[model samples]
Target: MVGLTLLALFIRLNAQDGILLYPDSYQFLLVIRGLAESIPLDAAMGAGGDAWSAPFYRLGYPILAFPLHLVIADPETAAKALSLAAGTAAVPVVYVLARLALRSRVAAIGAGLVTALSFSLANWSNFVMPEATAVFLLTLSMLLAYLTGRAGRAVAVAAALTTALLVFVRFEMLLVVPSLVAFIALGAGQERSKVLPAVRLYLTSLAGLIAAFALALWWAFGGVMSGLSVDPTSLFQAHVIESTTAAHQGAPALSGLRDFLDREPLLILAGGMGLALALRRRPDQRWALWLQMLPLLLLYGLRNDMRYFALLVPALAYASGLALDEGWAALRRLATSQRAAPALAVSATASLVVLTIVFWQTDLTN
Candidate 1:
């Protein structure tokens, strides 16, 4: 299934429609090409003043593309290639995460296929951005932290490194690390003695990550404070925080849930059902899922942009796959089992294919 998923994504991504998908794609290409031309990192910018440091996004994507820029000659092609590879690699990682969490082969494969075929997901691969890579690393980190009931130091270290790298890939990933630590600590099983050590290891790894990020920033920006100040404090502002927590009138609150439902109705229905199922049957997994999704949720509520919703697709797809798989299973037991099972599977598969095409077309036409 993993191999097939990879092939499917590769074929899709490799097909060029000659559309420059997003503004970010052009910026990424500029950065990659500039760096290849020996332009300083801080000086890498687009013709339109899209600076490398204006809002202080992570540098991992451009840095990772340097070798590709050197080898591929065309910066856009290199960037697309990078996204394609990262997005393709994420399929197996998504499978591992779903399989580990649900302990169900059908659910895991379904998740993998959903992720692989998702137009929103595959769209990332066809573009020149870090989202696909970020998704891949983020899912890998989640899997590493949860694969065992009690993770050892090596697993903790690996998970931490993956997460830290993910942060470098995209700064928003930083928001979820604390919750991830909590998730890792809970994975230490029921042994009280093992719990403290596990917590210590995860925290220490987190500290190491922070220090590494600080050092990288300091080197790039010339000082820790300077690097930190690249983005204004307003960057942290959100409608939920402003309305409910801070009760500030500076920015009007908005309904992210409503916007998501309006934009991606199918995903909202299936993913919401999946989420309810998780809350009911796999309460232990809820924290991790929330952490994975909360940043995007906040972004949606604050900005009301549907584009950020793509970041939540991995969790949504995983949850939806579980719901779809289990729902079909229960239906099979209640009726003419074999025939109903095939019918349900066929219908679900067809629905997914149609949704994928629709999403791709929508994004492209936009």
Candidate 2:
């Protein structure tokens, strides 16, 4: 885990030419600077000037980055630093999730290693945006949700809190609510009697936390809903209904998936095969994880933004690791029967490594 994390950090560090800032990055930087300097929310919202909102409503990322900003005295560097830290930290979280899903240390290690080398994850870590942090929190939420069955009440509470925090980071993350509920409802494994109570407990805790968070925001800002400038109905119509209609009309439905496959062919192929195997094997938590990924996949598939697919990197890497592990196991079984199997396995593994390197280089150039 330690090695994988360091490798992830190293890749992110070398992948950039200093801090990469975007239009959205400036919004976050303004908020981080405002928070660090004790500027009020309303003042911070207008800090950007020219009527550009400072993302005060999704304040979680800037709030977390403020301490770094205070020390570094550079909001851009601080924001990127926070992103790098979160992205690197996700390595172990991905490994843990893989371990829970596959129940194999080798597969878990493979997942961590693949995540470390992921170009998309590395690219996002280089940017001063909320994506890296959101991905980390999302992965953590998935882990906590997976743990609820084994750890019971405490884990359920933790999952709820994490889910609430995730939503705070990215309001769109509220889409995860149904998936989380499904996970909790079916988390108790074969303990059919415990499922309902566990789901109820999680829902109650999540509701309370969300309410408390809203109340705190309202008290601090003088109002909660007033800070948000977006109209929910319009946003839904534009982002959801319109996007879907457009996709069906002319835009390719699977463009986003195709973009990812072109960039990370081996990883995508392996992940697809692994997911197919998981479906056949029907692992205990397979459906929970799949449910969690469904909404994101659908949304991004419609949007066709490859960058948004970064959110799915860890999960895909986990599935890739599972596929690789299964392949190795099959080869081992063949090796016991045929003398040439060992040579074939070695050749196949070498080819995969070389191909992965080629893909990584191509992605870096792009």
Candidate 3:
């Protein structure tokens, strides 16, 4: 935990040279500054001084940074501070999930280290975007899912609430709702008699919260569809799905895959090996991991935004840690001679370090 905290602080403090604002960061800054004004709803303005509104972006991140902005009086620093704090909080959450679900302390520590150094996630801590917060929320959900096996109604309710709040951070988080429910069901399987009761309690709480949220939006906007600016399609009154999807269409799906491979080849490769290992050794956890990864897979296949890739960092890191541990065990078995074992261990560590450097350099060069 001390190591994780130091790594998080280092990443946060060393993201950029000077100015922390990026293209997306500035967009969020506009919203945050707008919210600081007396009339927040219509005060949002872009760099061009034109009125801007982002209904799909969610107000959660802005609200969190508003107080900090007031104190610091600098939009960029305030935004970065909020993101840094959220990203830092995610370190422990990832560790706990890896420990409980993967059942390996070494894997847990590796998970924490990987998450702290994840380029996509760490870089965003310098931005005003909500990606860091999303990572934290997702990790918390994973942790809760793992704990549901031993917990009762209170934990179930807490899990439901945490998952529910994720939607306010990113609408894509809604995909996790079904995944969380299935995970809780898997946990409930331990107690045959209590399975239905557990699932019912979880599902009921999640649904009720979502229903209330929808109703509030409906009343505020005259209709839920109105809040999203619905557009009619040529066919049978079908509404066009509008959000950030258009911005994601510029890049090809294969391009995103290539970028991920370049940025974190070892992590991605080890994660795949770990996935297979988990499937064989721990089928229950393997399924939960897959559930969490579904959104990232879909995004890669469809939208292909690198920023969206932060969603998979925690899961990939956890899987990579497991794979690394397995590789060490396999190498030890392969080296039958005591002298050969020591030599192989040194070689393996050196090779991983070299590979990490090469991948990071290649990713940056690309």
Residue-pair clashes per prediction, in order, are 0, 0, 0
Which pairs of residues collide in candidate 1? none
lDDT of each: 0.64, 0.71, 0.66
What's the TM-score of each model vs. the native? 0.76, 0.83, 0.80
Compute the lDDT of residue 236 as modeled in candidate 2. 39
RMSD of each: 5.5, 4.1, 4.7
lDDT per residue (tens digit) for residues 1-366 in model 3: 778878767766766445335555665676667656533333234445422233234556776687798998887778788888888888888887777666778788778877776777766776778888888887887678656655656577777777766766666677766666656666665675665666688778877876676566445433322323322122112111322354354666556566666676555766777777878876766766677677657744444556677788877877777776776666767677667868686867877985666447323213
The most accurate candidate by lDDT is: 2
> Against the true structure, candidate 2 has what lDDT?
0.71
TM-score computed on alpha carbons, candidate 2: 0.83
TM-score of 1: 0.76
lDDT by residue for model 2 over 1-366, one digit each (tens)? 788888788787777774447666777776677667755444224323523243554567877788899899788889888989998898999888778756788788778877877767777888887778888888787778767865677688899888888777776678777766655554566766776666778889988998788677556644322434444354334334433433333657676667776776655676777777767764654666576568778767755556667777766786777877787687677777756667686868877985667456435646
**Can you rank all candidates by lDDT, best first?**
2, 3, 1
Candidate 1 lDDT (Cα, 0 to 1): 0.64
Best by TM-score: 2
